[model samples]
Target: MVEIVPFGVEAWLNKREKSAKYDISQSTIASLTMHEVLNLDGNNGQEFYSMLDQQKMNYGWIEGSPEFKQEVAKLYQHVEPENVLQTNGATGANILALYSLIQPGDHVIAEYPSYQQLYDIPKSLGAKVDFWHIHEEANWYPDINELKKLIRPDTKMICLNNANNPTGTILDKQFLEQVVE
Candidate 1:
Protein backbone atom coordinates (compact mmCIF):
# COMPACT_ATOMS: atom_id res chain seq x y z
CA MET A 1 0.00 0.00 0.00
CA VAL A 2 1.30 3.43 -0.88
CA GLU A 3 1.44 5.76 2.11
CA ILE A 4 0.49 9.33 1.35
CA VAL A 5 3.05 11.85 2.48
CA PRO A 6 1.65 14.68 4.60
CA PHE A 7 2.00 18.36 3.71
CA GLY A 8 5.60 19.46 4.17
CA VAL A 9 7.24 21.51 6.96
CA GLU A 10 5.31 24.71 6.32
CA ALA A 11 1.94 23.03 6.82
CA TRP A 12 3.12 21.62 10.13
CA LEU A 13 4.22 25.08 11.23
CA ASN A 14 0.87 26.60 10.25
CA LYS A 15 -1.00 24.11 12.51
CA ARG A 16 1.51 24.61 15.35
CA GLU A 17 1.12 28.38 15.21
CA LYS A 18 -2.63 28.06 15.69
CA SER A 19 -2.26 26.05 18.94
CA ALA A 20 0.93 27.59 20.34
CA LYS A 21 2.15 31.16 20.79
CA TYR A 22 5.80 30.40 19.98
CA ASP A 23 6.74 28.95 16.60
CA ILE A 24 10.05 27.11 16.99
CA SER A 25 9.62 24.45 14.31
CA GLN A 26 10.29 26.65 11.27
CA SER A 27 13.59 25.92 9.49
CA THR A 28 13.91 29.11 7.50
CA ILE A 29 14.34 32.69 8.64
CA ALA A 30 11.32 35.00 8.99
CA SER A 31 10.05 36.36 5.70
CA LEU A 32 10.68 40.01 4.87
CA THR A 33 7.82 42.50 4.70
CA MET A 34 6.77 44.17 1.42
CA HIS A 35 8.18 47.49 2.66
CA GLU A 36 11.53 45.88 3.46
CA VAL A 37 11.55 44.01 0.10
CA LEU A 38 10.76 47.16 -1.93
CA ASN A 39 13.79 48.96 -0.42
CA LEU A 40 16.24 46.26 -1.61
CA ASP A 41 19.33 47.70 -3.40
CA GLY A 42 17.91 51.22 -2.82
CA ASN A 43 14.92 50.39 -5.04
CA ASN A 44 11.86 52.37 -3.91
CA GLY A 45 9.23 50.13 -5.66
CA GLN A 46 8.97 52.75 -8.49
CA GLU A 47 11.45 50.86 -10.69
CA PHE A 48 9.57 47.58 -10.11
CA TYR A 49 6.17 49.13 -10.85
CA SER A 50 7.53 50.83 -14.00
CA MET A 51 8.84 47.50 -15.33
CA LEU A 52 5.53 45.78 -14.49
CA ASP A 53 3.59 48.49 -16.37
CA GLN A 54 5.72 48.00 -19.51
CA GLN A 55 4.74 44.32 -19.93
CA LYS A 56 1.48 42.65 -21.02
CA MET A 57 1.96 40.02 -18.24
CA ASN A 58 -0.39 37.60 -20.08
CA TYR A 59 1.40 34.27 -19.45
CA GLY A 60 4.66 36.16 -20.17
CA TRP A 61 7.33 34.14 -22.07
CA ILE A 62 6.50 30.47 -22.67
CA GLU A 63 10.15 29.35 -22.74
CA GLY A 64 11.29 32.11 -20.40
CA SER A 65 12.52 35.49 -21.69
CA PRO A 66 15.61 35.32 -23.89
CA GLU A 67 17.42 37.73 -21.52
CA PHE A 68 16.48 35.66 -18.46
CA LYS A 69 17.51 32.38 -20.16
CA GLN A 70 20.80 33.99 -21.31
CA GLU A 71 21.60 35.13 -17.76
CA VAL A 72 20.81 31.66 -16.31
CA ALA A 73 22.93 29.99 -19.04
CA LYS A 74 25.91 32.18 -18.06
CA LEU A 75 25.94 30.47 -14.63
CA TYR A 76 26.94 27.13 -16.27
CA GLN A 77 30.06 26.28 -18.27
CA HIS A 78 29.66 25.48 -22.02
CA VAL A 79 25.92 26.23 -21.87
CA GLU A 80 23.90 28.40 -24.25
CA PRO A 81 20.60 30.32 -23.82
CA GLU A 82 18.71 27.64 -25.83
CA ASN A 83 19.65 25.02 -23.23
CA VAL A 84 17.88 26.73 -20.31
CA LEU A 85 14.18 26.00 -19.70
CA GLN A 86 12.66 28.00 -16.86
CA THR A 87 9.95 26.66 -14.52
CA ASN A 88 7.87 28.15 -11.72
CA GLY A 89 10.29 26.89 -9.03
CA ALA A 90 12.17 23.85 -7.73
CA THR A 91 8.99 21.75 -7.29
CA GLY A 92 7.90 22.30 -10.90
CA ALA A 93 11.38 21.54 -12.23
CA ASN A 94 11.67 18.42 -10.09
CA ILE A 95 8.25 17.12 -11.12
CA LEU A 96 8.89 17.79 -14.79
CA ALA A 97 12.29 16.09 -14.75
CA LEU A 98 11.14 13.07 -12.74
CA TYR A 99 7.91 12.51 -14.67
CA SER A 100 9.76 12.76 -17.96
CA LEU A 101 12.49 10.29 -16.99
CA ILE A 102 10.93 7.82 -14.52
CA GLN A 103 8.64 5.02 -15.71
CA PRO A 104 6.88 2.16 -13.91
CA GLY A 105 9.21 -0.72 -12.84
CA ASP A 106 12.33 1.43 -13.33
CA HIS A 107 14.85 1.32 -10.46
CA VAL A 108 15.96 4.57 -8.83
CA ILE A 109 18.43 5.21 -5.99
CA ALA A 110 17.77 8.38 -4.04
CA GLU A 111 19.62 9.87 -1.10
CA TYR A 112 17.87 9.55 2.25
CA PRO A 113 17.12 12.52 4.59
CA SER A 114 17.49 14.88 1.67
CA TYR A 115 14.37 16.41 0.07
CA GLN A 116 11.32 14.10 0.31
CA GLN A 117 10.39 14.69 -3.33
CA LEU A 118 13.74 13.19 -4.37
CA TYR A 119 12.52 9.71 -3.39
CA ASP A 120 8.86 9.85 -2.38
CA ILE A 121 7.52 10.97 -5.73
CA PRO A 122 9.38 8.26 -7.61
CA LYS A 123 8.15 5.58 -5.18
CA SER A 124 4.58 6.83 -5.52
CA LEU A 125 4.88 6.61 -9.28
CA GLY A 126 5.57 2.82 -9.09
CA ALA A 127 9.36 2.85 -9.44
CA LYS A 128 11.41 0.67 -7.09
CA VAL A 129 13.07 3.16 -4.73
CA ASP A 130 16.25 2.26 -2.86
CA PHE A 131 17.64 4.73 -0.37
CA TRP A 132 21.36 5.62 -0.45
CA HIS A 133 21.85 6.69 3.14
CA ILE A 134 24.02 9.53 4.40
CA HIS A 135 25.68 8.15 7.53
CA GLU A 136 25.34 10.37 10.59
CA GLU A 137 28.46 8.76 12.14
CA ALA A 138 30.47 9.75 9.06
CA ASN A 139 29.28 13.39 9.03
CA TRP A 140 26.25 12.75 6.76
CA TYR A 141 28.11 11.56 3.68
CA PRO A 142 27.06 8.51 1.71
CA ASP A 143 29.60 5.68 1.52
CA ILE A 144 30.96 5.36 -2.00
CA ASN A 145 31.47 1.60 -1.73
CA GLU A 146 27.84 1.18 -0.69
CA LEU A 147 26.77 3.32 -3.65
CA LYS A 148 28.80 1.13 -5.99
CA LYS A 149 27.13 -2.01 -4.55
CA LEU A 150 23.66 -0.49 -4.99
CA ILE A 151 24.09 0.16 -8.72
CA ARG A 152 22.71 -2.44 -11.17
CA PRO A 153 22.58 -2.27 -14.96
CA ASP A 154 18.84 -1.53 -14.74
CA THR A 155 19.22 1.43 -12.32
CA LYS A 156 17.65 4.29 -14.28
CA MET A 157 18.50 7.22 -12.07
CA ILE A 158 20.50 8.14 -8.97
CA CYS A 159 19.01 11.21 -7.31
CA LEU A 160 21.20 13.28 -4.99
CA ASN A 161 21.23 16.61 -3.22
CA ASN A 162 24.71 18.24 -3.51
CA ALA A 163 24.10 20.04 -0.21
CA ASN A 164 21.41 18.31 1.83
CA ASN A 165 18.48 20.33 3.02
CA PRO A 166 17.92 20.75 6.81
CA THR A 167 21.18 18.85 7.61
CA GLY A 168 23.23 21.18 5.30
CA THR A 169 25.80 18.48 4.59
CA ILE A 170 27.52 19.22 1.30
CA LEU A 171 29.12 16.74 -1.11
CA ASP A 172 32.52 18.32 -1.82
CA LYS A 173 33.96 18.76 -5.32
CA GLN A 174 36.45 15.84 -5.10
CA PHE A 175 33.80 13.44 -3.75
CA LEU A 176 31.35 14.56 -6.45
CA GLU A 177 33.96 13.95 -9.20
CA GLN A 178 34.50 10.42 -7.79
CA VAL A 179 30.76 9.80 -8.02
CA VAL A 180 30.81 10.94 -11.64
CA GLU A 181 33.56 8.39 -12.37
Candidate 2:
Protein backbone atom coordinates (compact mmCIF):
# COMPACT_ATOMS: atom_id res chain seq x y z
CA MET A 1 0.00 0.00 0.00
CA VAL A 2 1.13 3.52 -0.74
CA GLU A 3 1.42 6.21 1.94
CA ILE A 4 2.10 9.93 1.92
CA VAL A 5 4.78 11.59 4.02
CA PRO A 6 4.37 14.43 6.49
CA PHE A 7 5.20 17.95 5.23
CA GLY A 8 8.92 18.54 5.68
CA VAL A 9 8.77 22.03 7.15
CA GLU A 10 5.86 21.14 9.42
CA ALA A 11 7.59 17.99 10.65
CA TRP A 12 10.85 19.82 11.23
CA LEU A 13 8.99 22.64 13.00
CA ASN A 14 7.22 20.19 15.32
CA LYS A 15 10.53 18.57 16.23
CA ARG A 16 12.38 21.90 16.52
CA GLU A 17 9.79 23.33 18.91
CA LYS A 18 11.09 21.03 21.65
CA SER A 19 14.65 22.42 21.60
CA ALA A 20 15.15 25.47 19.36
CA LYS A 21 14.70 29.01 20.70
CA TYR A 22 14.60 30.69 17.29
CA ASP A 23 13.23 29.10 14.14
CA ILE A 24 14.89 29.98 10.84
CA SER A 25 13.74 26.88 9.03
CA GLN A 26 10.48 28.05 7.44
CA SER A 27 10.00 30.79 4.81
CA THR A 28 6.95 32.55 6.25
CA ILE A 29 7.40 35.75 8.16
CA ALA A 30 6.43 36.10 11.83
CA SER A 31 2.68 35.95 12.29
CA LEU A 32 0.67 38.88 13.58
CA THR A 33 -1.93 38.43 16.31
CA MET A 34 -5.57 39.16 15.42
CA HIS A 35 -5.63 42.41 17.29
CA GLU A 36 -2.38 43.59 15.76
CA VAL A 37 -3.52 42.54 12.30
CA LEU A 38 -6.92 44.19 12.58
CA ASN A 39 -5.45 47.46 13.84
CA LEU A 40 -3.55 47.90 10.58
CA ASP A 41 -6.67 49.44 8.96
CA GLY A 42 -6.55 52.36 11.45
CA ASN A 43 -10.21 52.13 12.47
CA ASN A 44 -9.61 50.65 15.92
CA GLY A 45 -10.76 47.29 14.43
CA GLN A 46 -14.47 48.03 14.95
CA GLU A 47 -15.52 48.13 11.30
CA PHE A 48 -14.05 44.72 10.47
CA TYR A 49 -15.36 43.10 13.66
CA SER A 50 -18.78 44.66 13.10
CA MET A 51 -18.94 43.18 9.60
CA LEU A 52 -17.99 39.76 10.92
CA ASP A 53 -20.45 40.05 13.79
CA GLN A 54 -23.29 40.72 11.38
CA GLN A 55 -22.37 37.88 9.01
CA LYS A 56 -24.44 34.70 9.27
CA MET A 57 -22.63 32.03 11.24
CA ASN A 58 -22.80 29.48 8.46
CA TYR A 59 -20.71 28.31 5.50
CA GLY A 60 -20.41 31.38 3.31
CA TRP A 61 -19.72 29.59 0.01
CA ILE A 62 -18.79 26.09 -1.07
CA GLU A 63 -16.63 27.02 -4.09
CA GLY A 64 -16.12 30.58 -3.02
CA SER A 65 -18.78 33.28 -3.39
CA PRO A 66 -19.41 34.82 -6.80
CA GLU A 67 -18.36 38.25 -5.47
CA PHE A 68 -15.23 36.88 -3.86
CA LYS A 69 -14.32 35.00 -7.02
CA GLN A 70 -15.05 38.11 -9.08
CA GLU A 71 -12.64 40.16 -6.99
CA VAL A 72 -9.98 37.47 -7.47
CA ALA A 73 -10.66 37.19 -11.20
CA LYS A 74 -10.15 40.91 -11.65
CA LEU A 75 -6.46 40.44 -10.88
CA TYR A 76 -5.90 38.15 -13.85
CA GLN A 77 -6.35 38.46 -17.60
CA HIS A 78 -8.76 36.19 -19.53
CA VAL A 79 -9.88 34.48 -16.32
CA GLU A 80 -13.56 34.31 -15.48
CA PRO A 81 -14.99 34.59 -11.97
CA GLU A 82 -16.21 30.99 -12.18
CA ASN A 83 -12.64 29.85 -12.86
CA VAL A 84 -11.33 31.22 -9.59
CA LEU A 85 -11.15 28.81 -6.66
CA GLN A 86 -10.65 29.76 -3.06
CA THR A 87 -8.69 27.29 -0.98
CA ASN A 88 -7.86 27.10 2.72
CA GLY A 89 -4.18 27.84 2.28
CA ALA A 90 -1.04 27.12 0.26
CA THR A 91 -1.21 23.41 1.11
CA GLY A 92 -4.80 23.26 -0.09
CA ALA A 93 -3.91 25.04 -3.35
CA ASN A 94 -0.96 22.70 -3.93
CA ILE A 95 -3.08 19.61 -3.29
CA LEU A 96 -5.89 20.87 -5.51
CA ALA A 97 -3.55 21.72 -8.41
CA LEU A 98 -1.72 18.39 -8.15
CA TYR A 99 -4.85 16.28 -7.77
CA SER A 100 -6.54 17.92 -10.73
CA LEU A 101 -3.58 17.54 -13.08
CA ILE A 102 -1.79 14.31 -12.15
CA GLN A 103 -2.85 10.71 -12.70
CA PRO A 104 -1.17 7.47 -11.74
CA GLY A 105 1.98 6.74 -13.84
CA ASP A 106 2.38 10.34 -14.99
CA HIS A 107 5.85 11.80 -14.69
CA VAL A 108 6.64 14.93 -12.71
CA ILE A 109 9.80 16.96 -12.12
CA ALA A 110 9.84 19.11 -8.99
CA GLU A 111 12.67 21.49 -8.20
CA TYR A 112 14.42 20.28 -5.07
CA PRO A 113 14.65 22.04 -1.66
CA SER A 114 11.25 23.67 -2.02
CA TYR A 115 8.23 23.12 0.24
CA GLN A 116 7.93 19.33 -0.04
CA GLN A 117 4.22 19.36 -0.83
CA LEU A 118 5.10 20.27 -4.46
CA TYR A 119 6.57 16.83 -5.06
CA ASP A 120 5.03 14.88 -2.18
CA ILE A 121 1.44 15.41 -3.31
CA PRO A 122 2.20 14.19 -6.83
CA LYS A 123 4.12 11.22 -5.40
CA SER A 124 1.15 10.37 -3.18
CA LEU A 125 -1.01 10.41 -6.30
CA GLY A 126 1.33 7.75 -7.81
CA ALA A 127 3.15 9.99 -10.26
CA LYS A 128 6.81 9.12 -10.82
CA VAL A 129 8.73 12.03 -9.29
CA ASP A 130 12.17 13.24 -10.32
CA PHE A 131 14.13 15.88 -8.49
CA TRP A 132 15.59 18.79 -10.47
CA HIS A 133 18.24 19.51 -7.91
CA ILE A 134 19.46 23.02 -7.15
CA HIS A 135 23.23 23.43 -6.89
CA GLU A 136 24.45 25.16 -3.75
CA GLU A 137 27.67 26.17 -5.45
CA ALA A 138 25.60 27.78 -8.25
CA ASN A 139 23.39 29.67 -5.76
CA TRP A 140 20.56 27.17 -5.33
CA TYR A 141 19.33 27.37 -8.92
CA PRO A 142 18.53 24.44 -11.16
CA ASP A 143 20.67 24.04 -14.27
CA ILE A 144 18.57 24.43 -17.42
CA ASN A 145 20.68 21.86 -19.29
CA GLU A 146 20.09 19.33 -16.50
CA LEU A 147 16.35 19.99 -16.75
CA LYS A 148 16.49 19.34 -20.53
CA LYS A 149 18.20 16.02 -19.84
CA LEU A 150 15.49 14.96 -17.37
CA ILE A 151 12.46 15.63 -19.56
CA ARG A 152 10.59 12.58 -20.86
CA PRO A 153 7.69 12.41 -23.32
CA ASP A 154 5.55 11.22 -20.36
CA THR A 155 6.47 14.22 -18.21
CA LYS A 156 3.11 15.73 -17.25
CA MET A 157 4.17 18.60 -15.08
CA ILE A 158 7.15 20.62 -13.91
CA CYS A 159 6.95 22.31 -10.51
CA LEU A 160 8.94 25.29 -9.33
CA ASN A 161 8.86 27.52 -6.28
CA ASN A 162 9.07 31.20 -7.28
CA ALA A 163 11.66 32.58 -4.89
CA ASN A 164 12.25 29.16 -3.32
CA ASN A 165 10.86 28.79 0.18
CA PRO A 166 13.82 28.65 2.56
CA THR A 167 16.66 30.06 0.47
CA GLY A 168 14.64 32.74 -1.42
CA THR A 169 16.39 31.84 -4.68
CA ILE A 170 14.62 33.20 -7.74
CA LEU A 171 14.72 31.86 -11.29
CA ASP A 172 15.71 34.79 -13.46
CA LYS A 173 14.35 35.70 -16.91
CA GLN A 174 17.30 34.35 -18.95
CA PHE A 175 17.24 31.02 -17.09
CA LEU A 176 13.48 30.80 -17.53
CA GLU A 177 13.78 31.48 -21.27
CA GLN A 178 16.35 28.73 -21.54
CA VAL A 179 13.99 26.36 -19.79
CA VAL A 180 11.18 27.35 -22.14
CA GLU A 181 13.40 26.62 -25.13
Candidate 3:
Protein backbone atom coordinates (compact mmCIF):
# COMPACT_ATOMS: atom_id res chain seq x y z
CA MET A 1 0.00 0.00 0.00
CA VAL A 2 1.21 3.52 -0.81
CA GLU A 3 0.82 6.44 1.58
CA ILE A 4 -0.75 9.56 0.13
CA VAL A 5 0.17 13.01 1.46
CA PRO A 6 -1.54 16.37 1.23
CA PHE A 7 0.02 18.22 -1.70
CA GLY A 8 -0.75 21.96 -1.38
CA VAL A 9 -1.91 24.94 0.69
CA GLU A 10 -5.57 23.94 0.35
CA ALA A 11 -4.90 20.64 2.09
CA TRP A 12 -2.95 22.32 4.85
CA LEU A 13 -5.71 24.90 5.24
CA ASN A 14 -8.37 22.21 5.54
CA LYS A 15 -6.29 20.47 8.22
CA ARG A 16 -5.62 23.80 9.90
CA GLU A 17 -9.29 24.38 10.76
CA LYS A 18 -9.09 21.58 13.34
CA SER A 19 -6.21 23.19 15.24
CA ALA A 20 -7.02 26.82 14.51
CA LYS A 21 -8.41 29.03 17.26
CA TYR A 22 -9.24 31.90 14.94
CA ASP A 23 -10.30 31.39 11.34
CA ILE A 24 -7.77 33.53 9.47
CA SER A 25 -7.41 31.27 6.46
CA GLN A 26 -8.16 33.00 3.14
CA SER A 27 -8.54 30.54 0.28
CA THR A 28 -11.87 28.80 0.87
CA ILE A 29 -15.36 29.67 -0.35
CA ALA A 30 -16.66 28.34 2.99
CA SER A 31 -15.41 31.47 4.71
CA LEU A 32 -17.72 33.62 2.61
CA THR A 33 -20.59 31.13 2.83
CA MET A 34 -20.27 30.76 6.59
CA HIS A 35 -20.20 34.49 7.10
CA GLU A 36 -23.16 34.94 4.69
CA VAL A 37 -21.29 37.83 3.13
CA LEU A 38 -21.42 36.95 -0.53
CA ASN A 39 -23.77 39.47 -2.04
CA LEU A 40 -25.49 38.43 -5.27
CA ASP A 41 -27.20 41.28 -7.11
CA GLY A 42 -28.30 41.95 -10.68
CA ASN A 43 -28.24 38.78 -12.84
CA ASN A 44 -25.98 36.84 -10.50
CA GLY A 45 -28.67 35.89 -8.01
CA GLN A 46 -31.24 35.29 -10.78
CA GLU A 47 -28.90 33.00 -12.67
CA PHE A 48 -28.05 31.04 -9.53
CA TYR A 49 -31.73 30.65 -8.66
CA SER A 50 -32.54 29.67 -12.24
CA MET A 51 -29.83 27.00 -12.14
CA LEU A 52 -31.24 25.68 -8.88
CA ASP A 53 -34.80 25.68 -10.25
CA GLN A 54 -33.76 23.73 -13.35
CA GLN A 55 -31.74 21.18 -11.30
CA LYS A 56 -28.88 22.07 -13.63
CA MET A 57 -26.00 21.19 -11.39
CA ASN A 58 -23.59 19.23 -13.49
CA TYR A 59 -19.80 19.70 -13.69
CA GLY A 60 -20.55 23.38 -14.41
CA TRP A 61 -18.28 24.28 -17.36
CA ILE A 62 -15.58 21.93 -18.57
CA GLU A 63 -12.22 23.84 -18.84
CA GLY A 64 -14.24 27.04 -18.22
CA SER A 65 -16.07 29.01 -20.93
CA PRO A 66 -14.41 30.96 -23.75
CA GLU A 67 -15.33 34.30 -22.15
CA PHE A 68 -13.97 33.12 -18.82
CA LYS A 69 -10.68 32.14 -20.44
CA GLN A 70 -10.52 35.49 -22.26
CA GLU A 71 -11.10 37.37 -18.99
CA VAL A 72 -8.32 35.42 -17.28
CA ALA A 73 -6.00 35.99 -20.24
CA LYS A 74 -6.59 39.76 -20.05
CA LEU A 75 -4.86 39.78 -16.68
CA TYR A 76 -1.59 38.98 -18.45
CA GLN A 77 -0.61 41.64 -20.97
CA HIS A 78 0.90 39.30 -23.58
CA VAL A 79 -0.97 36.06 -22.89
CA GLU A 80 -3.67 34.75 -25.22
CA PRO A 81 -6.93 33.11 -24.11
CA GLU A 82 -5.71 29.82 -25.66
CA ASN A 83 -2.67 30.04 -23.39
CA VAL A 84 -4.79 30.38 -20.25
CA LEU A 85 -5.85 27.14 -18.60
CA GLN A 86 -8.10 27.23 -15.55
CA THR A 87 -7.89 24.61 -12.82
CA ASN A 88 -9.86 24.06 -9.61
CA GLY A 89 -7.93 26.86 -7.98
CA ALA A 90 -4.42 28.27 -7.57
CA THR A 91 -3.21 25.05 -5.90
CA GLY A 92 -4.32 23.00 -8.89
CA ALA A 93 -2.78 25.61 -11.18
CA ASN A 94 0.54 25.43 -9.34
CA ILE A 95 0.55 21.64 -9.34
CA LEU A 96 -0.13 21.46 -13.07
CA ALA A 97 2.54 24.07 -13.86
CA LEU A 98 5.14 22.20 -11.83
CA TYR A 99 4.14 18.76 -13.11
CA SER A 100 4.37 19.91 -16.73
CA LEU A 101 7.51 22.04 -16.48
CA ILE A 102 9.77 20.28 -13.96
CA GLN A 103 11.61 16.99 -14.29
CA PRO A 104 13.52 14.92 -11.75
CA GLY A 105 16.85 16.45 -10.64
CA ASP A 106 15.92 19.87 -12.01
CA HIS A 107 17.15 22.84 -9.95
CA VAL A 108 14.34 25.08 -8.61
CA ILE A 109 14.50 28.29 -6.61
CA ALA A 110 11.44 29.21 -4.54
CA GLU A 111 10.68 32.00 -2.12
CA TYR A 112 10.79 31.01 1.51
CA PRO A 113 7.76 30.85 3.85
CA SER A 114 5.40 31.08 0.91
CA TYR A 115 2.47 28.78 0.20
CA GLN A 116 4.12 25.39 0.87
CA GLN A 117 3.11 24.01 -2.52
CA LEU A 118 5.54 26.39 -4.26
CA TYR A 119 8.54 24.30 -3.20
CA ASP A 120 7.20 21.12 -1.65
CA ILE A 121 5.57 19.75 -4.80
CA PRO A 122 8.81 20.16 -6.76
CA LYS A 123 10.66 18.37 -3.95
CA SER A 124 8.17 15.51 -4.17
CA LEU A 125 8.83 15.45 -7.91
CA GLY A 126 12.57 14.99 -7.21
CA ALA A 127 13.83 18.50 -7.92
CA LYS A 128 16.75 20.13 -6.12
CA VAL A 129 14.94 23.01 -4.35
CA ASP A 130 16.50 26.13 -2.82
CA PHE A 131 14.73 28.64 -0.60
CA TRP A 132 15.44 32.35 -1.01
CA HIS A 133 14.68 33.44 2.51
CA ILE A 134 12.65 36.53 3.36
CA HIS A 135 13.55 38.10 6.67
CA GLU A 136 10.87 39.38 9.04
CA GLU A 137 13.41 41.86 10.40
CA ALA A 138 13.63 43.27 6.87
CA ASN A 139 9.82 43.52 6.60
CA TRP A 140 9.63 40.03 5.07
CA TYR A 141 11.20 41.04 1.80
CA PRO A 142 13.95 39.02 0.14
CA ASP A 143 17.22 40.71 -0.75
CA ILE A 144 17.99 40.70 -4.47
CA ASN A 145 21.65 39.80 -3.90
CA GLU A 146 20.64 36.84 -1.75
CA LEU A 147 18.21 35.72 -4.43
CA LYS A 148 20.90 36.09 -7.11
CA LYS A 149 23.26 34.01 -4.97
CA LEU A 150 20.72 31.18 -4.81
CA ILE A 151 20.38 30.93 -8.60
CA ARG A 152 22.66 28.40 -10.29
CA PRO A 153 23.43 27.48 -13.90
CA ASP A 154 21.20 24.42 -13.55
CA THR A 155 18.17 26.37 -12.26
CA LYS A 156 15.12 25.46 -14.33
CA MET A 157 12.48 27.47 -12.47
CA ILE A 158 11.97 30.23 -9.90
CA CYS A 159 8.63 30.03 -8.07
CA LEU A 160 7.10 32.87 -6.09
CA ASN A 161 3.91 34.12 -4.44
CA ASN A 162 3.28 37.70 -5.56
CA ALA A 163 1.28 38.53 -2.46
CA ASN A 164 2.64 36.11 0.08
CA ASN A 165 0.34 33.86 2.04
CA PRO A 166 0.33 34.00 5.90
CA THR A 167 2.42 37.20 5.78
CA GLY A 168 0.37 39.17 3.21
CA THR A 169 3.50 40.76 1.81
CA ILE A 170 3.24 41.95 -1.77
CA LEU A 171 6.12 41.62 -4.24
CA ASP A 172 6.09 44.82 -6.29
CA LYS A 173 6.78 45.23 -10.02
CA GLN A 174 10.37 46.46 -9.54
CA PHE A 175 11.27 43.39 -7.49
CA LEU A 176 9.52 41.08 -9.95
CA GLU A 177 11.39 42.68 -12.87
CA GLN A 178 14.68 42.26 -11.00
CA VAL A 179 13.84 38.61 -10.44
CA VAL A 180 13.06 38.24 -14.14
CA GLU A 181 16.38 39.83 -15.13
Question: Best candidate, lDDT-wise?
Answer: 2
Model 2 residue 48 CA deviation (Å) reads 1.3
In candidate 2, list every pair of residues with a backbone clash. Answer: none
Candidate 1, residues 47-76, lDDT tens digits: the string is 877887898858778989999999999999
Cα lDDT, all candidates: 0.84, 0.88, 0.81
Separately for all candidates shown, the number of backbone clashes (residues 3 or more apart, or on different chains) is: 0, 0, 0
Per-residue lDDT value at 110 in model 1:
92
lDDT of 2 at 133: 92
Best by TM-score: 2
How should the candidates be ordered by lDDT, best one leading?
Answer: 2, 1, 3
Query: Per-residue lDDT tens digits of candidate 2, residues 133-156?
Result: 999999999888889989999999
Task: Give the 10-residue window scoring lowest on summed lDDT in candidate 2.
Answer: 21-30
Relative to the true structure, candidate 1 reaches a TM of 0.87
Better of 1 and 2 by lDDT: 2
Clashing pairs in 3: none
| Rank by TM-score (best first) | 2, 1, 3
Name the 10 consecutive residues with the lowest summed lDDT in model 1: 1-10
